[model samples]
Target chain A: MSSPEVLVHLHQKAVLLLQDDANKIEKLIEVQMENLATRKCPLYEEVLDTQMYGFSREVDFAVRAGLIEESAGKAIISKLERNLAQLYEALDQKSQLL
Target chain B: MSSPEVLVHLHQKAVLLLQDDANKIEKLIEVQMENLATRKCPLYEEVLDTQMYGFSREVDFAVRAGLIEESAGKAIISKLERNLAQLYEALDQKSQLL
Candidate 1:
């Protein structure tokens, strides 16, 4: 591969890896949201928080390493944050209903 | 730059960035070890743990992204873990003295 090709491939790979990590966290949020009323794992939130933190670190490193654009990294993280917010909102509504 | 040159440059840059992060954590450990008796920040350990987690995440991402060899990533993390263990041991001994 040429220089530009190599860089592009690396960038795509970095973004793909980050997206995979984000999807795992998204899955976690979905599971917790689905089981919000059934399985009361108190550590679910903690686990999610830790996962998000670790994933964010990965994103941050990618940005710094020039593997992906800063804007791309920010977009991925923002999307996850929005989903997480929605989950928390749903949890709040459920608590209010109870 | 040529393809090989580009790869070499990226690999070196990734290692440098990770080393910089590891050094920051080392500095944190050093500061805490120095203040092991006086400052008594109950949250120091928590902060260090969080930093270590974040740093490790960066290393893991770099390895997955193909920016660094897995062994290089492991070495960086292992060195930090050793220093961290020493700090904890010293903290333990100090408490024992108390």
Candidate 2:
């Protein structure tokens, strides 16, 4: 492959990998949302926060390494953050009802 | 640059980037150790753990992205883990002496 081709391939692979990670976090939020009635474990929030932090680090690394564009990385993270915020909102409402 | 050269350059760049991250964590541990005489903030451990978790994720992503070898990634993390463990041990010893 030529130089541009190599970069293109790496960029695509980087984006795919990041998307896959974002999906995993999405699944986590979904699972927690589904199980909201199962004795709200305090640890779940910590787990999600840690996962998000690690993911942000991964995204930052990809951007710094020039594997993915900065805007693309931020977009992926923003989507997940929105989902996370929704999850937190639901959790808050649940706690208030209790 | 040829295909092999491109790969080589990326691999080197990846290593350097990871090493730089590792050094930042190392510095965190060093500062905590040096400040052992002062009142130990419980939050430091949490911060270090979170940083380690994030760094490990970055290393994992680099390996998955083909920027670095699995063994190389593991080695970088292992070194940091050892340093972290030592810091914890020293903290424990200091607390016991108090």
Clash totals for all candidate models: 0, 0
DockQ scores for all the models shown?
0.89, 0.80
Query: Candidate 1 falls in which docking quality class?
Result: high
**lDDT for each residue of candidate 1 in A24-71, tens digit (9 for 90 to 100):** 999999998888887456588889899999999999999889888888
The Cα local distance difference test for each model comes to 0.92, 0.93
In candidate 1, position B68 carries an lDDT of: 94
Model 1 chain A — which ten-residue stretch has the worst lDDT?
Answer: A36-45
User: For residues B53-94, what per-residue lDDT tens digits would candidate 1 score against the true structure?
Assistant: 999999999999999999999999999999999999998888
Alpha-carbon lDDT of model 2: 0.93
Identify the candidate with maximal TM-score.
1
Per-model chain A TM:
0.94, 0.96
In candidate 2, what are the lDDT values of residues B58-82, reduced to their tens digit? 9999999999999999999999999
